[model samples]
Target: MRTPPTIPAHLPRLAARFDLSSEDLGNCAERCAARVQRLADLWSHAGTPPGQVMRTLRRTAKRHSVYMPQKDSAAECINRMSDPAWWRRALRKRFRAVELHAIQTGAVHRHASPYVSAKALRRHELNAARLAAQMDGLEAINQTTGEAVPMSDLIEASLANPANRRAALMARIKGIETSALAKSHVGLFLTITCPSRMHPRHSMSGAPNAAYDGTYPGRAHAYLSRVWSTATRRAAHLGLTAYGLRVVEPHHDACPHWHLLVFTPADQADAYADNLRAYALADSPNELGAQERRFTVKRIDPAKGSAVGYVAKYVSKSIDGEGVDFDSESDNDGRAAARRQIAWARTWGIRQFQFFGVPPITPTRELYRVSAAGLPGLALPELHQACKANDYAAWLATVEAHELRLGVDYAERESTRYRGETTKAISGLTVEGGDLTQPLSLVTRCDTWRIEPRAKGQAQAPSERAATGSDFSPWTRFNNSAPIDAKGLFPSDAPRAKTEKKGEEGETAVRGSVLHRAPLPGAGRGDWESARPAA
Candidate 1:
């Protein structure tokens, strides 16, 4: 007879803790039996007997409170329970509680939460408290910074701040204005194209990838840098010591381009443009090289408010296939050619550079303060004064009439609609004829007025007809003939007059008699009809 197998050492302890009713134990035994049979099949494939597999399974399951009623069931339970799904689900249910306990107890590891030292637990709590205090302090500081600070103030301050890298730039711009190199100035946009092409290794010929590679600043970037340096040097020579410039690299069809902003005098615009072009193309020593390459420059008008937007587009754009028209065969060819050109451009030994002259460093502090004061509250009184002074009262009356006709809530209307600040309301009172002291209504009067329906077949009244010239006398010769009936001389029934007409004396003249025709009014014949109706 076979010897009874020895129970695993941990089985007895597990059985004591998870003591179950016989019926429940029997159900577990049945599940374990099925598991054992499956394990036997698996292990036997590798030449291990079912009994040996059962022995190994029994040892494994005992540690996890999994019980096997028999040797065969041991293998079955081990095979089936090896999947930790049940344990994972159970852990998920207590995840939050487990995390909290781990924090409170200063647990070092997930499986050893109950074994943390008291010192470790206190350390974690202190660290948490310190972090909370830091966050609160940060919030308080943020609140005290004030919300009314203008964006212009922030930008100006950021540029002029001593610790900022742009401090030198600020100084340069300041020098230009103070030295009288430039008077009232405007900004310019410089577009520089590089002769260098992208390396063939990175070229995307087909779809025209617009992506830029930071690792490879490319010949375009190098060329831009040289142009910037040259331009700055030239500006210094012109007595514009303080100049500010921002150079950005842009990619088109895989080739690089530079976008630049500079501040200089408006009157010297032409000179600046010429000098910039010369400096940018200065790289070509020979006629052929100079003829083959060109640098493009454009001035940015600050009044247009598009300089910032123009710069941002190239900086943030990605070289995705989105903007490309892949359907066109020419586009594909162009892209391929561009990639080759990029590689060729590299041979020119051009490098990218962006430079701008700094604004005056001294005025930065005062300017920052002025900008910081923030925009004034709606200058309603000043606006009113301006309107009165400029005779804008009629305009105000017109606006008021429109508002009334529309039946809109005037008080609730947004000031932007009228191109004014919300804090100010347009007053209905206005001066007539630009007279600040006179009311608009008193300036003009409807001395003669008539109304008529726009619809067809509406009979006009006698007064309305006279007002409309319907009952007016017509032009007639002085031969003592019956006075030409106005209606007969110009019948409404006739076809509409041609837009073009001719005059008498064989000279091309306009038709249509004046209410009182004379030798043309400007001929110096004073009131021709009053002078000679018989002529």
Candidate 2:
């Protein structure tokens, strides 16, 4: 029997090592499937000619001013996405190093987590009865190793141990807690569930009556916004706007509920909850008792872990996220309708987490660099501004706009990179810069610095450079790569070379073979080299 899977945050560093016994080897298929899916997503433009994307980029590169890098270099940048370094940079642009660091260290032991198995599910009487009748058909015995593995053991490891994902999420949650603690005296962890479906798929089985629709999330968001507004009006000093976290929840019907965390002054806590209830009642329109449990809240205990943890706890455990294949209908049906919900959510690009009115987290890239060298934050204010805007270009602007308080140990350029730096300075920055996960600006998704200090005769202003949207796109690089299959099947999608008829004389086949043709008298002689086929 495999040991139960555990989450990262809940475990200490010692317990995080990869253990194969705890892993299941069944993910091989899923890995292959995921690779195919990635290839398909990356090569979606397989049908589009490369010239179309490249033409514009080339034009932009040739016409771009001094501010713009060379056209070939720009094209090469997109081409470099195939490199590991470029992939790392891409991920770095999207996430803070500290958050990634925690995830890396926590999930250091990457192995197939034995999160699902056949024997376990078969423990139930009905399932066991069904299995006993079909035991001979399983062919569970290993052909070579002769191990009697259960058939369930071979099921693709589609579902991961929720703990593996919680590692990164919890790290960010701790950051959120730090900000909440500093900015607001009071914090509430809360949940808001969507109403029972109006026309549920399984009205008798308690499936939603009214399924999640395109307008549902918008309506829910409007209701939540109104409730928060009502709460604010009810209490002047409540400071409900101090900090807020609304994590979009995915359900079986592909709808959303939300887990939210908000901060206020301690004295206004009661007033906040009461005003919320009142708004919930008032919005009932023609509704009766309880108003559908409108909302629920709990106090945060700073002494424990973090207030942010309570709300983010469900985020990584949910089925709808980065790893899911929203387009793949073959996704496991056993995961409680997660595939359908994921597909539904994917169609809309539903955000996993959203923040409103919270103090913006600062960019610590410089801090990370400086700290890596054991230096202090010399440009704190500028860092804060860039962080507040969550813009990479703005961050570069901040890098140039400020002067640093240098010490004897400081160097001209700090060695900050996406990975492998450990210094107390970085640790301090991680503590101070909480939850930098939100997509705060356009630059947040980009790795390259779009803004540079202006030259006397600069080619383009920073704002203009930002708008140019790079004419030489990265997608054209796919032209250099092997084409992906339209159907995304492994082995099956691979390109097959055309072959000539076997009977026709061709370079592919040996003409005077020992099996059919008369053996040549000097076939093995070095002197007969001139008679070799052109191949």
Candidate 3:
């Protein structure tokens, strides 16, 4: 968590003098001077190395060399570095140390606070970046396997193997339906496409078919911005309240395209397609060929398709392909070129999976899911507030108040057989909530719950009413866990079952068939994939 700003003693008077909001004070991380000094201190002679020193000197020389200070020796450099204000100025002029970071809160959870911390770590850019990805929000777990693979990897792998891509996509559709947003609202698979360039266009000198085109980002970004600005306005005219879950994918030659799962009021599905076309054409005149079928909207089927799985797959594609084109038809060379473009974009600091409107899901809905599922997780409001402010003290207070534990711990404790100390195979799991700490026992207290169990040859999920009629707690489900499809997750070897203790409900806890082991090679970090569903 960023350290909170100390409130000025005269803040009440200051606020009255110049109308300010509490959020303004609550949002402040520190007084400007402290931040300046820290970055400035990093550039000091003791702090900066020989390469930085040379770079600084070179930059200084380029900026009016004749007026350069005479401090050239190591001793003189150290003397100059002693001046904090001077280093701050040099650092700002040389690099954007001031523009620094956005400090995206709620992206990650350290022990005390629920927030993400980001910066260019010394000498470990890629590793630091990946570490930061730990804060990316959660998507649905594959219902059959209970595995939480990054959505993009699953989509790409499925698309690449055309023989099974259809089934995989269908599976993703259902998974999307299980999530908070897609479950409640009408989701439409929407595409906003740019005019296809017959050949690569360049602003600077470069070949049309150049592997890494310098012009693609600018052109793609401009087109996306233009269409998006107009599209939202059109949505307003159509009287639709829209929320989008979208992904930006690079085209074959590196131009960008969008894949979107948009949620609007549930009853608007029938009229969406016509309005979408009108929206696309509103800004694009026929003379400019803007009417070329550049927009598409397909209403999601709650029965078999999911908006979450559809859009999430595209988000995953951007990084898994490492920025290569998403098409499966590409040869090795095409794939390589795609990777290069992605790397180049990263080097230029392009954002992947950005948004143009409100996020489709809300934090309250997330917490409710955790609560309804009888899962152990964090208090939603406390976490919600912590994600807003930059108060280190408030972060510490949250940490002190809540007894946070890992999902694994919750799983073990909730196990009927393993409710005490005896060990046995582990079966089944419950994953819920967002990027930060989860509150334990939030949902277990709720009297109502609907649990869907996996059974043989079940195409349609039984109604919610039917689910509540059975014993569907983790204990019962894990004990009776059965295989549903090929997507089922299981350890390579199955374990034998044993006896267990009884719960307060007087039901005997059967030993489980699933057990936790390290994930297979290339599995997600710290994810429990070794334990497959009970067969």
Candidate 4:
């Protein structure tokens, strides 16, 4: 039995108007009640109408009751919305002091906050709920064939396997090295950074930066994105074509910077660098070290290392830290650093790596699902031969040729096609631009799955399997099984039931039978051979 929490004396009328009572407050917890009281006081102090404040509280209560219909959940919802202290504790696992401070102070309300916004966290929580449902042995039943797979298993397979992701990135890099781009173009390793004001802390000392402008990591990321867009737009106006990988990484202060491994015509590399620098310093141009640190371009020398080698560490560090030894930003080992980077990216919904001036990865993945032979009649038919051959380099060439023939901006076309889809999963590709009308769609994912709890006896616990010594060799679906087709060789030694008339005799007889039937070591042609019947 739980005790009812005591509501503040001043809030009695407000609580009464909302039809809430002390018994109902019991579910809210003392801490939650206090936070709600605090928010109510804040509302009153702001000169809000008494009726409006009551209505607002009731609305928050009702909105939250949809998911949690408990008596006290409404009060808890109010606490979640207004309490800065609660937000700090809730986000402590993923973000620290400076970041949390920014989140609490910058937002006008909890609904539209920055740096891991309420919406993003709610989305993550929903995903976590789905994952939890899967972990609870829920199976995704395919409606078509009536086949079912563990949702957890599907999730694991769909997630980017670190090793495979790194391998694919390296393969793409190698493809670029051997292509025409490598012949007439120079590889430039460019670094674009946010202004000093955006970073909250110093990189070397881990202390707050004196020039910090109190910008959240998410906002700073957006600023960097805008700057890059401006620079790229300028480059486009100059007719300077560049293509390659872009890696976004966080500074020690949680501000973002970009590392681009770009291949551009040798003659235009300097011009591209100049434009990037100009835009990078467009804001706060007079800040200390702005000129030197904002944008940097390094020309890759083939004699030193391949362009892939130059960006491999960045790719590895961002993904799984396969070949990375240390991370200077976090002062941690490769794997630990990678974990932090991934956390930062997920929290802020930032894309860590992107391939520019190439066919979008989403479309390529969709293309792989469809029959290559059938692609000749589909949109972007130039990619059909490349898909048939499974050659990435050839695909790159064909996409470029196709773009030239279409006379449409490839990036814009792909971007437009990808919009208006649900964020849950990529259903398929929508072909836009070129001769394609309005948006010709392809239905690649036709399977519909519904998650349901595992039926009794459908799955076995590991402990149960271990105790039984069960080996579903060449037949049953145990995860671990023997290679040979041997079955029933190791019979169970479960005790036999006792007879009512001769319990002791029955037990003795059963024991004797079990021992007689049990296979013994070296019983074939060794000492036990004398016990065997005549051949």
Worst 10 residues of 1 by lDDT: 441-450
Best by TM-score: 4
Q: Candidate 2 overall Cα lDDT vs. reference?
A: 0.35
Q: What are the per-residue Cα lDDT tens digits for candidate 2 across 1-535?
A: 3321322343333222211111121232234334434543454456434555455434432331101222343234234332343333232222212222222222211121011112212222333344333431332222222333222211111012222223323433444555546545677876665444311122123222333222333355455566666666765565443456667654322335567777777877777766666665564434432354546778887877566457533453344232333322113322433333333333333565666653232233222112112112444445544433323334434444453221111112221321222222111122222232321111111011111122334333223534764222111101111112212222331232212123422212112211111111111111101122234
Which candidate model has the greater lDDT, 1 or 3?
Answer: 3
Give the CA lDDT, 0 to 100, for residue 267 in model 2: 73
Ranking of predictions according to lDDT: 4, 3, 2, 1
For each candidate in the order shown, give its overall lDDT on alpha carbons. 0.33, 0.35, 0.36, 0.53
Model 3, position 353, has a per-residue lDDT of 55
Off by over 4 Å in 2: 1-166, 179-184, 195-204, 207-239, 285-289, 302-309, 319-341, 359-362, 365-535
Predicted candidate 3 versus true structure: per-residue lDDT over 1-535, tens digit per residue: 4421322344334324322222332222123234434544676636667566656654543442112335555334433433433443333222111111111111111221111112221112453344334322222243334543332232222222222332333333333344325236677787776553421422222223322222334455676767666766776787866655556654433455567776666776656555666655554345344565467767777577556445534543443432234444223333443343344344224555543344222222222222112222354345434323212223234434553222322222222211122232223222334433533322111111122222333222224323644212212211122111133221221122222332323121112221221112112222222232244
lDDT of each residue in 1-535, candidate 4, tens digit only: 2311221332333323333222333334445546656876687578766566656666654543312222243333453445433433333223322233433233211123312334334444555554455444755454434755543343332323355456556666666765645357788999989888776556665554567656767788899889988889999998888889889987755678999988888888898888888898899999889888888888898878788788888888887776688877666678766765665677666899888886565565444434333332343665644543435666677666445222111111121112221113333455555444454444333333455677865544434544765422111111111111112111221112111222221111110121111111110111111111123
Best by lDDT: 4
What is the total number of backbone clashes in candidate 2? Answer: 13
lDDT of 1 by residue, 337-449 (tens): 22223222322223322344432222111111111111222332233332222222222333343331111011222322112213222111222222123222100000111
Global CA lDDT computed for model 4? 0.53
**Any idea what lDDT model 1 has?**
0.33
